[model samples]
Target: MKFTEGMWRLREGIRIDWMNNVERLRVENENVELLLNKFQRHRGDTLNSATVTASVTSPLEGIIGVKLVHWAGQVDNGPHYQLASSSGHTKINHEKTETLSYDSGALNLAINTAPNELDFVFSGAKGKLTGHSWRSIGYVGDQTTEKSQWDDGIFFERQGYMLAALDLGVGEKLYGLGERFGPLVKNGQTVDIWNEDGGTSSELAYKNIPFYVSSKGYGVFVNHPGKVSFELQSERTTRVNISVPGEELEYFIIYGETLKEVISRYTALTGRPSLVPSWSYNLWLTTSFTTNYDEQTVTGFLDGFRDRDIPLGVFHFDSFWMKSYQWCDFEFDEELFPDAGGYLKRLRERDLKISVWINPYVGQASPLFQEGKKNGYFIKRTDGSVWQWDLWQAGMAVVDFTNPDACTWFSNHMQRLMDLGVDTFKTDFAERIPYKNIQYHDGSDPARMHNYYTLLFNKVVYEAMISRYGKSNSLLFARSSCPGGQVYPVHWGGDCESTYEAMAESLRGGLSLMLSGYIFWASDIGGFEGTPPPALYKRWVQFGLLSSHSRLHGSSSFRVPWIYGEDCSDVLRDCVKRKILLTPYLLAEALAGYNEGTPVMRPMFLEFPEDLNTYPLDTQYMFGSNLLVAPVFTDEGTVTFYVPHTPEDSQGKWVSWFDHSKTYEPGQWYTETHGFDTLPILIRPGSVTPINPKLKAPQDDALNGLEVLVNGSLANDMAVQVVNPSKTHNVLKVIKIESQSGNVTADDAGVKVVRIGH
Candidate 1:
């Protein structure tokens, strides 16, 4: 994707035609069109050169889109991200002699139309955000050379690419390129927005979204389904270079007053995350992959949890539930469980929901494979044969989701599992799609469908679950995702190692995904690759139980807490009980994520954007708007975290949630050692956190024993809304508390209130 050798020269066989000057500009009803050509000194200089056409329009009130086309004749086949747009009005001002401006809400795009000055500057009410200037827009071509090799091992006569570079200001950092694991900040990195099945310790990502929010109160979304390569200050040091294949490239500039507002506008254009069921917020135990497990093993795991006094919510069956080499058949191995339906019914009687693993693949050994191959339900080659690969399964063929019959065929199989009392699905492995020499039934571009296949794969399964269960009950533990995939809730970090480094990497990935508009995220509890040490397992349990969703899954080994030690089970029970008590506060944060695009596990910068210290701190995060959670990554239980200062706090102080008497000054770093049961969970000043002390499960009535923990002094009156566990956006009751002479008093007579840091 890199075309330049340095600043002065291009690489071999590379040709770039940059947009130099605007020859003509036309405005029609808030839409601006520009006909740009290369730098011309005379009339005959424009005879044989190519011209670029640019269109600018407002999709929503606070967003502006720009589409640049090198060749306008290519047909846009299909497989586009579903985006929502409003018919927002904009103001056009071309009367000025030097600049032509378009205003959408408070965001303004001013184009310098002075003779040879072709610059596009985006500004807000505060100041300028970012812009494009000289040599920023170009059409690149790679002619065949000795070393010219394209992505798919095929060399073309001339491959075309369109690129645009935006300015990166001093001290500005970029974040959220979709579940990245390298670092929180994306500067000085070469990121390719292509989905892969790579694990958490590399630069490759399972989810690759082409949207990034900046520290300058703005964000940019590249609207391309295929691979979009970004050189974030890596190539040119002061620019974000984005290049995509084919004839056209489109991008949107979203502006907001804060980082959270930028995410709100971005998700409004794509889709909001759906609210999951309350029981899903509790603990989930799964059969480890590649481990020898029958009904007895699963039963023993469940019994162990109950005997240890730990609350269990759901039980999941991994891939071995099906026969070997016959996935997507959706049948339990009769050898393993002779009475599959009866066993599921018995588990359901235990007040537990069931989840099963499934993927969009049909091995040749499966009976459905022959049925699909004959009915044209699988992806086919150009010769009309079903495409086959022997990677994960023998002779595995991908289900063609482009055909409506194929989708129905796949969903019917899932419904069979649902009929057996299966409550949800763990949709896995859509990232290894074959993009070469294969064709979709709908004739979508193969490279584009590679990343988009995850959406179709999850959408089919999610809709099937919604048909069986209601909206609030349907959930998917998905792995791969794209731009519009946030509508399906609860994705997890895939295939991490069993080490402390991987645990921190998983947190970084989850925080990155949350910033990308995803609401709920989880990771493999004790890691997925190896046997975790007892200290590592106990530490991970505390971190995992505090996440939006918690699951214990691994490969080749069991993830039962007692396998480590007896102390591990006790630590896990303590964490699970604490999470059950904190359900009222967690559900309220989830409602904010469902209504707006606020993340439940958000980075520190999202809350304190004014503090410079919060931008570089990815080791800790805000669990909600009020509480800060710093997970203990070290086995020794020593953790150092920073408490941020905000303008609203009269006395800059934060109170510890574990011990109410312990307080810390803001804008200072503190290091503390904790046992297996505690970490640094700090409550923000002047905030009310609701807790249900008597709840046994997350689905219990929150109003039964609700108590509001008031931190520091309340300067103003506030109301705490206790969300209903069974319904979405339903608030059971509001507890109004007034600040009387710096003392907190609740209006509801029966509600108990506790004041901290008095």
Candidate 2:
């Protein structure tokens, strides 16, 4: 993806034609077009050279999209990212021979048209954000010449690439390239936007989205489905170089007054995260992969949680549910689960939901594989044979979701499971798709479908679930995703090792994904690769239960809490109870995420955009708009976290949720040691959190025993929306609380009020 060796020279076998001057400019309504050619000195300079055609338009109110094309004759196949657009919101101005500007809301794109100088400058309400200047836009050719047997038969094959570089301002930090695990700040990093199955320890990511939010109150989304490479301050040190191997490169510049508003607009263009069911917020226990488990083993795990007085929500059956070597058969192993339907019915009677594991692969041993091969329902090679690989399963063939009949065939199998009382599915492993010498049934470009395969795979299964269950109850614990995949709720960080470092990385990945327009995210509670030590398990349990979704899963060992120690179970029970009490507040945040694209688990900068101290702090995050959660990473239970100062807080203070008497001033850092039962959960000033202490499960009515917990003094009366747990986006009531004489009282006489700090 790197084309230059340094500033002065290009790499071998590379030729780049940078856009130097605009030869002609045309405006049609709100759309602008430009014909850019190389530096023009005279009429002789215009012969036999490459030129780039640029088109600019506004997709949304505050977004401007630019497409640079090197060649307009190449055919563009299918597999494009879905974008929402609106018209009649743009204003265009053309000043004679000097400058041309296009305005979308408060964001403006200005082109400098003075004779040999062509530059594109983007400005917002807060002055210039970023722009293209110097050697910023170019078309590159990578070629190799070969000689044939005859001396005259010499030929060259060249791969064309279009690139655009945008200016990076001083101290501007970038984030959210899709669940990255390296660092929260994306400066000095070369990121390749390709989906892979690599674990949490590598730069390779399972979810690679080509959208990034900047610290400068703006964001850029590269509108490509295929591989888009980004050199973030690594190549030029002051530019974000974006290159794609094709005829054209399209990107959108989104601007807002704040970072949260920028993300809101980005998600509006891509897709908004769907609201997941409330019970999914509770604890989920899974049968660990490769562990010896049958119906009896699953029963014992359930019994263990019940005997220890721990509340459970969903019980998941991992890959072993089906026979070995037959993954997508969708039938229970007769040797292990003789009466699968009866067992699921009994679990349903006990008020538990059932989730089973599945992938978009049909192994050769599965009966459906032969059916699919005969019907041409799988991805095929040029010879019209199914593409097979022996990586995860024997002779595994990827199901072609592009074919309508193939999608129906796959969904019918899922429907059979739904008839047996399965409530949801853990859609896993669509990242390892083949892109070379393969063809989709719908004739989509293979390279483009490589990352887009997960979207189709999850959509098929998610729609199946919605058909069986209503939209309010449909959910998927998906593993891989792309740009518009947020419409299918609930994805998790995949395949982490059982260690404190991996636990911290999982948190970093989840926080990064939330910033990418995903609302609900989880990780393997105690990690997934190896058995976790008791200390690590207890710490991870606390962190996992606080997330939007919680699950306990591992690779070789069972994730049952009592397997570690009695203390682990006690700590997990307390965390689960606390989460159940916090469900009323969490549901409100989920509604915001669904309605406005505001993430439930937010980075600190998203909440306090004006506070410079909050920009670099990824170790902690705002649980919603109010509570700050700093997970204890070390076994010693020592953590240092920061509290930010805001104008909303009169006293500029934060109160600890654990010890209500303990308070800390804002704009300072504090280090504290906690036991296994506690970490730092601080409530921001002037916030009221609704709690239901008597609720046993998240499915229970949250309004039954709701109590408003006021954190600090309220300058004015605040209204809190109490959400109904069973329905989506349904508000049961809004409780109005009046703050008088350092004490708060609710308007509803039946609701109890609890005050934390005065």
Candidate 3:
């Protein structure tokens, strides 16, 4: 992806023809088309070589879109991300002597029209955020005449790359590239938007979205489902370079005065996160992958949670639920689950939702493989044969979701499982899709389909659930995603080791995901690859309980509390109980996500955008607009965190939710010591957090008795919305907790107000 060794010279075999000047501009009704030439001396200078044409349009209010093309022979096949609007209402005008400008709502774009120069600047309400200048746009190619070792014909086609470099300002930072596990700041990183199955330890990401927001108050979204190579201050120190392998590249420049607004607009253009079931916010227990478990082991684990008084919502069955090497047969292993229907009935009778793991793979050992191949349900190679590989399963073929009958075939299998009482599907492992010589059913671009396949894969299962159970009851435990994948509810961090470091990395990934328009995210509680020690297990329990969704899972060992130590049971119980108690509050935040595109687990910068300190801080995050959760990530239980504040905001107070007697002022760093049972959870100032302390199950209709905790002074009246299990908020009965005046009242309801720090 990097084309240069350093600033001075290009890397070997790389040839770039940069866009030097705009030769002529043609104005249209909604857009402007510009023909670009490399040389500006004479008309005949545009002889035997390359030329570029750019189409500028606006897809939404305050969003500028530019599509640059170098060749016309590329096919229009697509697995394109569904844009909410193709184009917005636009206005265009030009000055006679110098420039041509386009305005869409508050965003404005101006292009300098001088003979030998091409400068495009994007400005929001405040001023110019970023722009393209000089030789920033380019058509790149690898001119290696040597034959490819894999195939001689492969090198004959001169596949070109389209690249654009947007100017970056001094001290500007970049964030959000779809659940990255590396640094929170994206500078000095070469990020390629390619989905891979590599675990959380590596640069490969399961969800690689081609969009990023800058600290300079704008966002750039590469409008390609294919791989987008980004050099964020790496190849070029002062610019963020974006490149895609194709004849054309298109990108959208969205402007917002605040970063939160930027995310809102971006989500509006792509898709907003769907509202998941409220019960999904509760604790989930899984049959750990690769662990020896049968009906007895499963019943014992459920009974163990009941015996310990832990409130569990959903129980998941991992890959071993199906017969070995026969995944996607969608049948429970007969030896392990002889009475699959009756066993699921018993679990449902116990008020537990059932989730089973499923991928889009049809293994050759299974009967579904032949059915899929015969019906053209599997992805095919160019030679008209089903593509098979031995990576995860022997002779596995990926299901081609582009085929309608294939989708129907897969959905019917899921519906059969639903008839057996499976509540949700953990849609997993589409990140390893093959790209070489692949042929989709609908002739989609294979490069684009590599990442977009997960979107369609999750969508097929999600829609099946919705068709069966209705939207309110639908949810998915997806492992891979793309830009529009937020339409599905929940995604988990993939394959992390059982360590505190892995836990921290998981949090970083989750926070990064939230910034990328994903509302809900979870991870393996005791980690996925190995068993965590008692200390790490207990700490992870607390952290996971606070997340939007929690699941106890492991790779080789069962994640039951007793496996670590006896005390872990208590830690797990307390956290699960607390999570259940906070369900009303959490579900309200989930509603906020659906309505506003705000992430429930928000990074600190989203909450406190004016404070520069919060930009790179990923250790702590705000759980909704209130509660700040600083997860304890070390063995010693020592913690350090910062509370952001400006001059006018310094007078506010941060009250500790765990220790009522402890309070801290804003705008300073604080350190503390604690046991495994406690971490730093602080309620922000001017907020009213509703708590349902006596709830035993997440689905219980227990909003009748509510305890409101008022933090600091609510300069204005604070109202907390109580929503039911359904999507509707109970607007008739409102709870008002008056601050600066210790008066609290409810609209003829049983609500109690407790003042924490007045």
Weakest ten-residue segment in model 3 by summed lDDT: 145-154
Model 1: weakest 10-residue lDDT segment is 739-748
After superposing candidate 2, which stretches have Cα over 4 Å from the reference?
A: 144-155, 739-747
Model 3 agreement with the true structure over 337-377: per-residue lDDT tens digits: 99999999999999999999999998899989888989999
Least accurate stretch of 10 residues (summed lDDT) in model 2?
144-153
Report, for every candidate in turn, its global Cα lDDT versus the true structure: 0.91, 0.91, 0.87
TM-score of 2: 0.98
lDDT of 1 by residue, 678-753 (tens): 8999999878889999999999989889888888677778888889999856988888877663333435767778
Q: How close is candidate 3 to the true structure, as a TM-score?
A: 0.97
Better of 1 and 3 by TM-score: 1
TM-score for each predicted model, relative to the true structure: 0.98, 0.98, 0.97
- TM-score winner among the candidates? 2
